[model samples]
Target: MVANTQMDADKVKIMGSKVKVDSIMKVADIEEAEKQKMKRKVDKILAYKPDVFINRQLVYNYPEQLLADAGVMVIEHADFDGMERLAAVLGAEILSTFDDPKSDVLGSCAGIEEIMIGEDKVIKFAGCQRNEACSIVLRGSGNHILDEAERSLHDAICVLVSAVKNHRTIYGGGNAEIRMSLAVHDLANTVEGKQALAIEAFSRALRQ
Candidate 1:
């Protein structure tokens, strides 16, 4: 049984990594849940738990979906119409959140891999990969974020994407990889700026 702690981390790593998720998740369904809990949401969940538990089903009375697969963030089918959705969603963050641009970015994103539900498809989630010091001002090589909403959106995409892109460094299923979908230097301080950013992002997704 995988812990919920791996949820968020797995999401980003998978989406960013370059691998085949459908084949991997098709084989490993259970581990996918475990990855999501530990990678993305456990720490946040534990804060409410006060004490951890056996599976993602918390012993404490907290939002169960917080650990369930439904809560995991993911983007689907990056090869087709998915890229546009991913671009705005993944690149929604700005420089303040470390979504900045750099020449040394080995890969646009950094994260793990896993699978998803409803369909027999695996995915790779990306955007703002995990780091010891996870924030906007990470090293030259770092995934970034801009705001809380963007972070949440990022997590959602990570879940779906991660299952697609498995780790190449490993044997069958490894970490995933993703690239910057969009780049916004100055986020709108005014209500319109914020709205514009969102509109632009989704618009780009529609275009793709």
Candidate 2:
């Protein structure tokens, strides 16, 4: 996966414009210049062999056709947050320029494919380096339900991150709680001050 962070077609066109005599340029010349500029950008991107391309802005048909020919999948108008998450999941560094694309900066995935989810077409990336990439497709009858589902998903992800960082997994059936409560109770008995009472209270709460 490689992303062209600069998705400004107008900027490329501006750079392609030539300053001619009498400040006049033929329409054909301008069009050809733009096409050449787009071709260069596309060629540079294709050289990276990115299985997927995430564009922040709309991609024109010309470049899209080129990518298709190269067997590269593209996701246009991707959100910034999505792109950041993708980079993390792929263990890939985001490069702003193709001037010197190192292997370390390129991301690889086992595969990418488009799948039909209901009436919509969804792109799925598989076997990323992190193996933690996920996509949530929400189906709701109304906007309110979708919004609520999104908020719930965000909260669930936060909890998952916290759990992963802690590197602890406890079994169900309150076994962990019982063990923690007992440990805390024992520690409280060793305390020499009134603070022990607070500790005991916490331990009891855990047991409950």
Candidate 3:
């Protein structure tokens, strides 16, 4: 994933808080510098030969066209949190700088595409590492509804991830609690004295 700041070539300014400085450069020189920086970033990304490029900020036409020409899918405006989630889902590393992107940092996906669901357009990544990636398209009548839906989906995903990592299952309707209570009760029966009474009480609480 390529997530870098895209500097505006037309907007060049020098400002400092504790110190003052004066510097001038030709417009062509400034623009050329920006283009060079962008080219370096693109080259670093292309070195990995990634199947998809996820940009944290909106990519200008130049970089977008460059990646497209190289036959790589591009996802623009993916915020920091979204990028982190994608990295986790794809089992990839987020390299702050592309100086040395080792083989371990690269991620793979079967394919990526832009799909329209309802009134919204979303990019979908398929066949991610361990099939861990998923995308949900929310449809709502208002902003409030959409916000609520997003929050709900986030909570659900958190629970799902926890369950997957733990590799433990517990049934609903208090069935697991009942089973625990029964096991504790059996253990209490095997013991003797006041400690047994305490264990019995604990098991009873679990039943409640």
Candidate 4:
């Protein structure tokens, strides 16, 4: 996926690193040759009969058009992290070559479709092999609002994860503070010294 597919060959051996074309006719011939090579590469891919193809690198116009014409959804320039996670979620491997693609090496999902979200096109994958695979889409009128929402959501998720791992629970929304303050006040009443004054001060600070 991470190759310049528009080039004549994915791995080219330069005979003399500095060859110059003589005229416009030569340039045209070279371009035509590269186009034909790309056509062959695309044809090889079409023979696999894939419903969708995702590339971590660019898929230029020519090959992109060829795949589209063959009714294959081509998604190019996929982010590396997302691609890695997707491979794990779908129980598939990240392949460098398609010389011999097998059914077991391919990923599958129930469906993939494009949806519009706040003026942007987004691809949605449904019914993934991993039941835990999911996505959260946040929409807002402004970027700041969306950023704040994302931060809050991330914090909430972290809290839930911590609770699951630690198996601990505590009151939220200032209730814990009030309870601590009351407990500290009760302890201060049992003592008689400047330490009690300090404890009362600490409890008062927690109330504030």
Q: Which stretches of candidate 4 lie over 4 Å from their true place?
A: 1-17, 23-25, 141-144, 163-208
Model 1, 53-169: lDDT tens per residue? 223222322224443443433221133233333333333211111122342321234544565543444445445333212222212223454355567767986865676686433
Error of 2 at 9 (Å): 3.3
Name the best candidate (by lDDT).
Answer: 2
Task: Give the top-scoring candidate (TM-score).
Answer: 4
RMSD of each: 27.0, 7.2, 7.6, 6.1
Candidate 4, 41-123: lDDT as tens digits: 88776666778878777777788888899998888877777887777666667766667746676677888889998788887
* Model 3: lDDT of residue 171: 76
Q: Please identify model 1 stretches exceeding 4 Å from their true place.
A: 1-77, 92-107, 126-208
Ranking by TM-score: 4, 2, 3, 1
Q: Which window of 10 residues has the lowest lDDT sum in candidate 3? A: 4-13
Give Cα distance to truth, residue 166, candidate 3, Å: 7.6
In TM-score terms, candidate 1 sits at: 0.17
Q: After superposition, how far is residue 101 of candidate 1 from its true place, in Å?
A: 12
In the range 1-208, model 2's lDDT, one tens digit per residue, is 5464654452334465675545345656666677777779888888777777777667778888888899877788767777777887788876667777566777777877889988988777788878556677899999999999999999999988989899877779999999999999999999978899999999999999
* Pairs in steric clash, model 2: none
Task: Point out where model 3 deviates above 4 Å.
Answer: 2-25, 136-208
Clashing pairs in 3: none
The TM-score values for the models, in the order shown, are: 0.17, 0.61, 0.59, 0.62
Tens digit of per-residue lDDT, candidate 3, span 51-148: 67776777777777777889877777777877877887777886657777677787777777788887767777788885555556788999999999
